[model samples]
Target: MGLGLGFELLKTEGAARRGRLTTAHGAVETPAFMPVGTVGTVKGMLPGSVRETGAQILLGNTYHLMLRPTAERVAQFGGLHRFMNWNGPILTDSGGFQVMSLSDLRTLDEDGVTFKSHLDGRRHRLTPERSMRIQHLLDSNVTMCLDECTPFPATHEVAEKSMRLSMRWARRSRDAFVERPGYGLFGIVQGGVYPDLRAESVEALTGIGFDGYAVGGLAVGEGQQMMFDVLDFTTPLMPADRPRYLMGVGRPSDLIGAVRRGIDMFDCVMPTRSGRTGQAFVRRGVLNMRNARHAHDTRPLDEECRCPACRDYTRGYLHHLFRAGEMLGPMLLTWHNLTYYQDLMAELRRAIEEGCFERRAAELEAGLALGDLPAVPDPLAGPVAAPPVPEESSSVPVDL
Candidate 1:
């Protein structure tokens, strides 16, 4: 039976851990990967398909959902879960990231941000209280506090000022989130790679008290090593019992590193976004299906996988679908990529439970280094050279 929302750390292998997050809809095993479904839908994916990929939770964006469908409309129909037909947990992000990224038509003030919509140039404002109210109306199982994503490469002084401002907003976000049983509110830690500021931010949020804590402000164009370094210093400062979420994070390598460093949850658009662009992620690496060499290949995208795309279609068919601009190509690849990510998470959880996470992590990293099957030449490129493959490329097999 699905338990109400609560996080339980089940096992640990070094700082790396595995856990169960019981939500009103279902039990999600962690460390977990939540496929980004901003605006209540993961593009090119049906909710049932997403569930079939092993995702027990999905992420919605307050900014987009509020702007388009309007939170009230979703609530009127039934909250986000019923509206989207996803019974599993739904985690909603505060509108802060979108407001910061969509900055051209926005004004920033101490209270929050005032912006013109990218959709239709309509005026709007987003403050901590407003953000909380929006998520509450959407009935998010897990809600994030509104905090600015301090831009990368910011000077120490600028970073400090932004961090402090976010801290104040965190308090407001905390005070505004409605307390209810079987729901959670998470505070985001922002310090822009500075250890001292990160510590201060974590301490401030801990003082404010939240159901969970997120390591924010990393993976915003900062390289992996730097992001990992910050996590190395910052995650330990977070309370051990609460779930540790890394927001807006990255590739397979980044997820592996974060899991090793104690992150319990992640949400990113890489896999889905990449899938739309003809990029396919497999256990071996990434492949671009638009390449011309696949025009004659009859093999599945990844022979060892069982996603619908791989189960029912050939590389030649996928290549033709993409070349012909059929929507099915993107849908198939997106499904495969999401399935791969969820499988990766489940494998990690099992590895931790079985006390072999170290070995599994090393193996995954080694496989990533081996690269993907060569992509066919892009027709637009005319006479493009073959993709480079290291001498040891053939060593890694597609296993997912």
Candidate 2:
């Protein structure tokens, strides 16, 4: 392998591809979904449970980690992997996104962005050099370069200016990165929605060189079609041998679409976030537990699913827990959602290997549109008893 982040294309069907990426922790299957562990944890799920969901890598936020445990502390404790007790690879953002998104107030310059922290209103500075330093201290397997995440709905001029500034920062980030075996620095390509600017951004970053490339700035409120259009042109311009990561994107359909456009990696908060809100993802489609229609439903979220949420609980139980604001609601749903995503990734990899990705993609899209199970019988409206739980399974509630 070239380093911690290296791509090897195994199969291809048109623009779609099947590949493997090597990292210090292990090899991650291509077109994989990396769960967002913003603060060294993937929300409600434990690190072991997260691995059970087939996640080979997890993302950590430089802004949050730096503020909370502080990079120095994390380093002292033996980096993010040992600190979090997770053996899998971890990718740390450049602290640029959080600075732009979470910083209460901020100003940008050639040096970096100066902002007030959202946590305690403490002032801080984040530049390419500082970002590299933080991720290095964390000993992140993959580190992102510090770059301005252009504001949403920007005009052509505004986007261009921001894109150019981020390009300059990319060079500085590369220069500051420590050259070590099995460590990588990724340069983000930002151009908002302009194709020309995106091309220019790519050229600049490629000239500077990086271990990998990420397509940033698309998932910031732009519609799906626009995002796809940007990926259509942008992904091809990136080095084919290196990994192409679509950062902070997206829903299940988005993953499928991006993979169809030749993307090799992805990370997002949709599955975990939706799970916390009592939403379970199934092959058929998304199911919401908040709806009154499932008050006495006996069916599982997906009859075909073999996950804990679907195996041990009925729609009624999940519905009741969600309505009661129970922690189990988030836990079970998060688990199910993650399981579903992992299964989907496995299916995609299989299809790509079988040389039938296009056909499989069509089947998946059509299946998800078929919708959910019918509403259950109401006990008040009719004499119906609650469904019995399986004998071997315990329904004990615990906080995630």
Candidate 3:
């Protein structure tokens, strides 16, 4: 399936995989977490900063890029890597998920999907051929096939119908793909939460073939256990030789769990999005930086980490930035959270290579389960009449 590059499965511990994917840009370590750069840039981050966070790859959105500056315009600028100045592997979504998210504005047919841009009311058509063309124009190292993201809680009948349509599209996407040295195409398997449909989907996509196979249509409305259950039965059925990707998923815990179940690659906006919203991820779980508790706390975000935010800034300063609505708040938090995710992936890879995946995963989960460290004790008269709550906002968030 790899025309110019291949995935090397370097090690395994149970279902966990420690592998490397070679691409024109560079090699991506498996169980890799790709930061979402929806519109050609990882928001608030320089390419060097992203590299500092240990990110070997980034994810781009076809729909967003196509809408704003337009894919053709990007091609004129010498593709996404040059336009964005990111010199690593880039994977482009087929624009299918974004199109499906606009269900009210989109129409589906055997040939393709036609939808209006969320930005403007202007119309655009996305076929397997067009998606392939767009990613190619952007010089994507890895391109996803166009496929409908099946809704969760779907009846078997409905899920099967959606999956069949996607399989057809996957074939068209493969046929339309322009193979080049170091670039590869991946097919997405979609089948709601139905096991039978999932099996059928695995068979279909593998038969058609791809450089990698992705498990799509998850983390939509399905709960974590259901999502894990889907993976539990699904990954065992995919090709062992090719990389296995889990798309649009998830929290740190989800990444760990999926890697345990054999997923090699993942992309989601959770870290960056959560960062912008004042949420910071730590090994002991997420902490709300905007909470009044952090406004007085003098500790770094995480004492164990070395990211800039945690290395140079204190929690109090971060809280003040968010309170004042400063731009640097999101920037610092984004950097810290990305560093946490990448560090977790590195640990997982090491665990697999060292043959201690189960033990390491359990230890990581234990830390997260312990929750945010107990509220730092404040002495003297219940913190001296519970220091006046900052009134920078309409209502203060609960201090935890």
Better candidate number, 1 or 3, judged by TM-score: 3
- What does the lDDT come to for candidate 2? 0.88
**Top-TM-score candidate index:** 3
Better of 1 and 3 by lDDT: 3
- Span of ten consecutive residues with least summed lDDT in model 2: 380-389
TM-score between model 3 and native = 0.94
Per-residue lDDT for 74-155 in model 1, tens only?
A: 9998899999999999999998888999868889889999999899999998999999999999999999999989999998
List runs of model 2 lying over 4 Å from the truth: 1-4, 102-104, 383-400
Write out the backbone clash pairs for model 1.
Answer: 293-376
Report the number of the highest-lDDT candidate.
Answer: 3
lDDT of 2 by residue, 1-400 (tens): 1354666888888888888877778788887888889998998898999988888989999999988989999999999999998998888988898788863488888899998888888988888999999999998989999999987799999999999999999999988998776689999999999999999999999888888899999888988999999999898899887888999988888888898998877888888999999788888789888998888788888887777899999988999999999999999999888888888888888999999999999899888888886565676775445566578878753332
Candidate 3 on 1-400: residue-level lDDT in tens? 5555588999998899999999999999988999999999999899999999999999999999988899999999999999999999999999998999998999999999989988779999999999999999999999999999998778989899999999999999999998898999999988888889999999999998899999999999898999999999999999998999999999989999999999999999999999999999999999999898887677898999989999999998999999999999999999999999999999999999999999999999999988887666534325233355677756655544
TM-score of 2: 0.93
Q: Regarding lDDT, does 2 or 3 come out ahead?
A: 3
**Model 1 stretches astray by more than 4 angstroms:** 1-5, 374-400
List TM-score per model, in order: 0.92, 0.93, 0.94
Better of 1 and 2 by lDDT: 1
